[model samples]
Target: LVVLLVRLHLTGFFWGDCSLSNTLFRRSAGEFAAYLVDAETGELHGVLSYGQRAYDLDLLSTNVFGELLDLQAGELLDADVDPATLVARIGERYDDLWRALTDVEEFSVDEMWRIEQRIERLNRLGFDVDELDIVTDWDGATVRIQPKVVEAEHHARRLQGLTGLDVEESQARRLLNDLDAFAAAHGLQAEDPMIIAHRWVTDVYEPLRAMIPDPLRGIVEPAEMYHDILVHRWFLSERAGDEVDFFDAARSYVESILPARAATVSAAETSGPDELSAVSPSDDDPSFD
Candidate 1:
């Protein structure tokens, strides 16, 4: 919590409300990351005062307590757990998060590669630092820097750039990694990542998608389907002691795995796609019986 608060402060924003429930977790390059979601009440400030920061922490504790109580009521929390202690622990976690996001490093001017290193650090934390606010003093001897316009969900944009597919942040990160691996394994190199992503989709993703029978098509989203297919391929390769052909793995996935999942319902509570047509009047039928 402290870490996020520090980063937000460094970036010139005040999170008026901060709590566990207001954040979502995603895995970035094998590390867990927290993203702020309830920013509707947050304030953008040039700097946060000590009192303001404390108030945010207080709100966070209160919110955590309430969430724990609610979960207990719902029978989701362990009976032995103490909410007060848990709330305190949450603060520690936030502090660590804040440090990771805003900690600075000193590098000699000769080590210009540190700038790229910093960007890579932020990307692994699931952020894109759109602007780096760097200042060179009058002496032109010292450099001070902070990231401005830092935005969350970095992988989502990268996935869109590559595949024109927008997925949950974590899923996009996973898919992007797989795409890179696919490119390397095929000895393909091009500046356009999207071209490679397109080839993978058309050659690999779409064929697997088409294998789904119409009756079971709505069980999962296309991106999720593709993710599962990749997992299946890995397992198949491991079992056979050789790389499984993509098409063969896809066929096995569609036949064996996808059928057992529950059918995905439409947003309006309709039975299925055919449900609409079944209820509609036929063109030749008279309105009056």
Candidate 2:
């Protein structure tokens, strides 16, 4: 979340009225992919001053805390989660990340360690430094360095190259790990990558995707289905006291887990002006926000 805020701030987006309801989350390798859904009050500047960035983060933290409190009241949030502490942590982490990205450090020419350290830190945080702006003293004995441009999505590109699959960063990492496992199990590790990828698409990815019924296809993307099945496989294996075969695991997932989700994606596509809202259950109140 610290990385998300800093990266968005770097790219000139100021989400003026940030809130939990304005974001959509997708499961990703035990984490989540958070997409900004409602930008109604957002503004884009060429650059933001520290004060402006702080203001945005403050709004986000406050709104998120309130949302957490509401969920806790409804018994939806974990009992141990504290809203105030969570919000405070966000502010503290945001400050640290902001400093890392924008602070300037002066180091002597002999201290090349400083140069590599900055790049390594950003890369570890899933950012790529495209270029550096370095200024040396008149005698070239000291230097100041700054990352000119930092971009995210390192894993996404690697997965795309290997399998032509476009997925979120965390999902891509999960899938790539699976692909490697498949190659090793089948003795395809030394074979040409394209051939290995083709077999994976045919023997692994495609079969998993094809298992979804046509009526349920829109509920989740192919890559997401694959990831979920992988997770489902683990639980199924755990219960059986041994590893579950991929197809059996996938069948169990579809039978037990996919039904409740069928309406979700289709509902999102439907809420457009031309579409009618579904009838609400009689016991449910309609006026609540």
Range of the 10 consecutive residues with the lowest summed lDDT in candidate 2: 280-289
**Candidate 1's residue-wise lDDT over 1-289, tens digit each?**
4445556766667787887778876433323457788899899887777677678878878987998898888776778998989888866876665655666655556666777888898899778888886666677666666665677678989888777876767678888887888788877776477778888878766776688788766656666666667777787888899999878887887776655432322322556445544544344422100
lDDT tens digits by residue: candidate 2, 48-151: 88788889898989899999999888876778899998889998998887777767778999997989999888766666778888999999999999887878
Cα RMSD for candidates in order: 10.5, 6.5
Clashing pairs in 1: 1-94, 1-95, 2-94, 2-95, 3-98, 4-98
Model 2 alpha-carbon miss at residue 121, Å: 5.0
Question: Which residue pairs in candidate 2 collide?
Answer: none
Q: What lDDT does candidate 1 reach at residue 17?
A: 80
Q: TM-scores of the models, in the given order? A: 0.68, 0.76
Instruction: Give the per-residue Cα lDDT of candidate 1 at 130.
Output: 86
How many clashes (backbone atoms < 3 Å, residues ≥3 apart in a chain or on different chains) does model 2 have?
Answer: 0
Error of 1 at 145 (Å): 1.8
